[model samples]
Target chain A: MYGLIGKMRAARGQRDAVMDVLRETTGALPGCLSYVIAIDPVDADAIWVTEVWTDQASHKASLQLPEVQAAIAKARPFIAGFEFQVETRPVGGFGLPTAEPG
Target chain B: MYGLIGKMRAARGQRDAVMDVLRETTGALPGCLSYVIAIDPVDADAIWVTEVWTDQASHKASLQLPEVQAAIAKARPFIAGFEFQVETRPVGGFGLPTAEPG
Candidate 1:
């Protein structure tokens, strides 16, 4: 499985503004299976995102579009900087035990 | 599933040091079903982690332990900062569609 995980820092007091845009744009990305945003309790300005996507190609295509770029640009000012990682989990990767069918 | 997704910025030239500790300590986290660390290809010092845990209690306990604390301290110098999200996915949460048993 291919996924994107990353964190973005919101400008001193603009965290809420950034989050608003994230909530608005997530549903537009069809490739995204799950897109979650969370704030750090200890550091309020820190925002994190964990996303699972259909595949890298779809994700790459989504990023190249103008809509996504515009949303990112809107958030960039509030964000100090970001660190993120992209990875692929091999098929049958370990995690929650498979749920048994009822 | 209870998971932790976050990013940490490594101090200039210190990414490898932080990663080394992560690789070393993951097996010790029994609640952790998967612990992954990936570096942004575009930014060498940026590190991201996507983790899946058995539950929140187990994860909280792990964080309170001395070993984990010590590890965090060691990695802190290399890390500029972090933004992480902690979330729980309800049963049957979206994604991966379920694998068919052979």
Candidate 2:
């Protein structure tokens, strides 16, 4: 599976709002195994997003989806800038969404 | 829920070995909702661990479990050192472990 770990910084006092947009727009996407938005404890404005997908194509496809595009548009104003984006491969672990029967 | 995103550096040429131990020792942890091991794409020797738990106490308590302790011991030699550790609160997400029957 494909994985992405990225850090995003929100504008001052806008972290909650940014997360709200994320919550609204995320989920229900096919091929998404895991997608978590977390608050960075020390840096009040920083949020880390962890994502797991069945493959790279699936993740790329999600970005082109209307909901995700709307999320980016809605969240852009409150975002300061991204810190980093790292991609990886997930071999195995817990809490991954189970595969549905074909 | 409690979330942790950490970067661990492995000894030269030992990334797979380190991840191997992690895969063997990470699952079925009580209170652990997710524990994913991913390789940092840009850094050949670095790995990122993303974890979620039901609560802080449960996470802390797991450190004392024999399996966890054994994992630390078993993987230590191949570890270079931790780069960073960030704690986060997960307000909502996908692929988090569903609550078990009470």
Candidate 3:
């Protein structure tokens, strides 16, 4: 499955606000297996987003969903910067969907 | 729940070996809600492990499990370095268990 893990910064003193915006992304994002928003205990302004999807296209397509687009717009102001980003392929573990053989 | 997100580098030509070690960690970790091993698409030596547990104590206790201890020892040689580590509290998301009210 396609995976994305990234570190992001919230506007100064706005980490909680940014988290709220992300938490609202419970819209119908088909193929999205996991979309976790977590607070970084070490950095007040840092937040981590970890995502897993059935495929790359499913992930890309979710970006255009009206709800997702709206979330991006709403969260723009609170986003300060991104520290790092990486694309990944999930191997296996608990709480993840079983990957289908290609 | 307690959460941990970290980036790890595998020794040269041993990423898959390192992943195998981690993936074999499917032992009975009581409170481990999620433990995913993902490969970094951009870096051959980089891997990301995202984990969530019911509580801090559960996570801490897991380190002492025989299987986990064994895996750590087996993978130590192939483990090059840890790029970063962070503690977190998950707010909400899919593929995660609901947080119980305290």
| C-alpha positional error of residue B22 in candidate 1 after TM-score superposition, expressed in Å | 19
lDDT, candidate 1, B2-80, per-residue tens: 5666667888898888878776566536576555555666777777666666667888888888878888887777777
Best by lDDT: 2
Which of the predicted structures, 1 or 3, would earn the higher DockQ when compared with the native? 3
Clashing pairs in 3: none
- Rank order by TM-score, top first? 2, 3, 1
Error of 2 at B6 (Å): 1.2
Identify the superior model by lDDT, candidate 2 or candidate 3. 2
**Cα lDDT for residue B67, model 3?**
87
Model 1 chain B weakest 10-residue run by lDDT? B93-102
TM-score of each: 0.49, 0.91, 0.90
Candidate 3 stretches with Cα past 4 Å from truth are: A99-102, B99-102
Quality of candidate 3 docking, DockQ: 0.55
What interface RMSD does each of the candidate structures achieve?
A: 9.7, 5.4, 4.1
RMSD of 3: 2.8
lDDT of model 3, residue B20: 81
DockQ of each: 0.09, 0.48, 0.55
What lDDT is reached at residue B1 by model 2?
86
